[model samples]
Target: MPCIPRLSAPHFLSIALAAASFGAAAQQPQLSAVDLARKNACMACHGLVHKQVGPGFAQIAERYRGDAAAPARLADKIRNGSVGTWGRVIMPRQSLVSEADAQVLARWVLAQPQQQQPPAR
Candidate 1:
């Protein structure tokens, strides 16, 4: 006969607590950036990873890596519109998207993971 080990009370309590925490987290609303982007139609031109009409958020992050002022600059670009920076595609001025929202979106983009290029020999 195979013997089965019984879980201790402390172990069971910890498991229950972890499950509850996970459930709570799962019930929380989507990240603010995602919600804002969805509400403003930003996803129509930009994606988290792959390129849409504009460069991917990750690519933007990579391009501005190590720049301390990137967030502020990106926020300005979001509001004022930019062209010739990423080909002939023109980013129309987002007058509807508030400055605060633009800042939040820029921060979110900067937080995304950048693709690491392999080191050259």
Candidate 2:
């Protein structure tokens, strides 16, 4: 028969606390940017990797990669929609999404990785 080592009370308490902490973290909202976008119907016009009615998220990230004010600027643009940037396509003002949520979404978009280019042959 194999003898199992019994854990000390402190060790058990620590393990239980760690697991409980992880459970709390898991309970916290972990929705991704894409999920938020979808929930707010932004996916109707934009996409993560490809263009639909508007430019894709990756393209937007590439366009604003160097600008330090991209997050704030994009957040404003989201709250108050504009035209002529991508084309004549009109982005209606997003009144339903809260300003804080708009900023969160904008930050998420800005944090997206730029599209990778193919290596030279």
Candidate 3:
């Protein structure tokens, strides 16, 4: 006969609580720059508000604020980098994103207002 270890009531409750906490955290939409940067590999080539190999999110946001279609367009440009946009340091097209991911990034970028915003006229 094999002896099996049983979980105590306290142990089970702790596990349940941990699981519930994780579930709640997951349910909360990660509409944050930290989350976006960590999830999308932004740190690989770009910093939060500084210049890395590429421009930062703040620069992008400041450049495209108040334009409704700007988010969609920026997302598309991220997936497909352009020339002469930021000097000759061309950003290569990222092949690891979906439209949904792009939208998330775009929304996150647009949400940041730490820098200057475009004219409201």
Candidate 4:
């Protein structure tokens, strides 16, 4: 008969700690669209409700509403960058963002509530 070797208390505790740490990392929450935007520095030139160096997210949503192709177009713009669409302010290419993530971000931007325009005097 073969006998199994038993681990010492210290070795057992070390193995448990390593397993716990691995589980903690694996169970970490996924980043939301807003969080992803911040992580990728999208918030630097854009805002949720107001324009900064770029148009607000709500504004983009309003502009693209009912346009079925907007999602794909926006996603392309996000990954490859765009120029002159919103005047001469060029949107630099975000090569770091994966295609799937860019699509997620585009959908998120397009899902923002439409901003109310001010009444003309």
Candidate 5:
């Protein structure tokens, strides 16, 4: 059998570090809807409970509640952008977000709970 060359301590350490990093990266958790929204800047204009530049996530959920087509409509709006739906606020197109990601975001927005109204005294 041919003799194998031994790896030096520095080479072994570098290889080990690279392997550890690769494993860590591979084991990273999947991105949730909220994470995806934040990554795509959706949270910049829409908040979970209150409106920012646009309507809140809960408000969108409330508005589209019981509507079967809401998901598709919202996804379309997300990808292509929209206007007049929420008055003069213009939702610029998010061309960088994938179709699947847009759908996920739409579903997430639709799942938000409506804000509770104060009880009348």
Candidate 6:
């Protein structure tokens, strides 16, 4: 059998540094399909966690939770940006997003976990 080489202190430190760097990178959340859509300027109106000129992403998730048909309904709404649910906030329809993009975005959005704010003290 071949003898195993021992690692020196500096070699061990380098290994630790490399592992730490990789761990930090892995801890970051990946951009979802919808995130790309948002970065493409879809969020000029709609927001991720809070309400802006448009309804909040959390609000949409809440409104459609458990609805089997919400994906289709939301996809249509995004494609057209029609108003009525949240009120007169006209959702200026997006022609920039494609049908596939709409579907991917809808699924990613609907799949997001809901976050609640703490009661104001």
TM-score of each: 0.69, 0.70, 0.62, 0.79, 0.76, 0.65
- TM-score for candidate 5, residues paired by index: 0.76
What's every prediction's RMSD, in angstroms?
12.6, 10.2, 6.8, 2.4, 3.2, 9.5
Q: Is candidate 3 or candidate 6 better by TM-score?
A: 6
lDDT tens readout by residue for model 2, 76-120: 889899899998988889988788889989998888887888899
What is the overall TM-score of model 4 with all chains considered together?
0.79
Clash pairs detected, candidate 2:
none
Kindly list the per-residue Cα lDDT of model 6 for residues 1-121, writing each as its tens digit.
9999999999999999999999999898756786766666767877887788887777888778999999988888778778878888887787777777777778777876788678999
Q: Is candidate 1 or candidate 5 better by lDDT?
A: 5
Residues forming the 10-long window of minimal summed lDDT in candidate 6: 30-39
Error of 6 at 18 (Å): 39
Q: Write the per-residue lDDT of candidate 3 for residues 1-121, one digit (tens) a residue.
A: 9998899999999999999999999898745646755776877888778789888878877777788999888788768867678788787776586677777787787776676457899
Q: lDDT scores for all predictions? A: 0.90, 0.89, 0.78, 0.93, 0.93, 0.80
How far off is residue 17 in model 1, in Å? 37
Between prediction 1 and prediction 3, which has the larger lDDT? 1
Q: Return model 1's CA RMSD, one decimal.
A: 12.6
Q: Write the per-residue lDDT of candidate 5 for residues 1-115, one digit (tens) a residue.
A: 9999999999999999999999999999878998999899888899888889999999899999999999999999999999999899999999998999999999999998867
Q: Least accurate stretch of 10 residues (summed lDDT) in model 3? A: 30-39
Lowest-sum lDDT 10-residue window in model 1: 28-37
Tens-place lDDT digits, model 1, residues 1-121? 8998899999999999999999999898645998998898888999887789998989898889889999999999999999988899898899898889899999988888868777999
Candidate 2 deviant stretches above 4 angstroms: 1-31, 119-121
Candidate 5, 103: how far from true, in Å?
0.6
Better of 2 and 4 by lDDT: 4
Q: Highest TM-score, which number? A: 4
TM-score of 3: 0.62
Ranking by lDDT: 5, 4, 1, 2, 6, 3
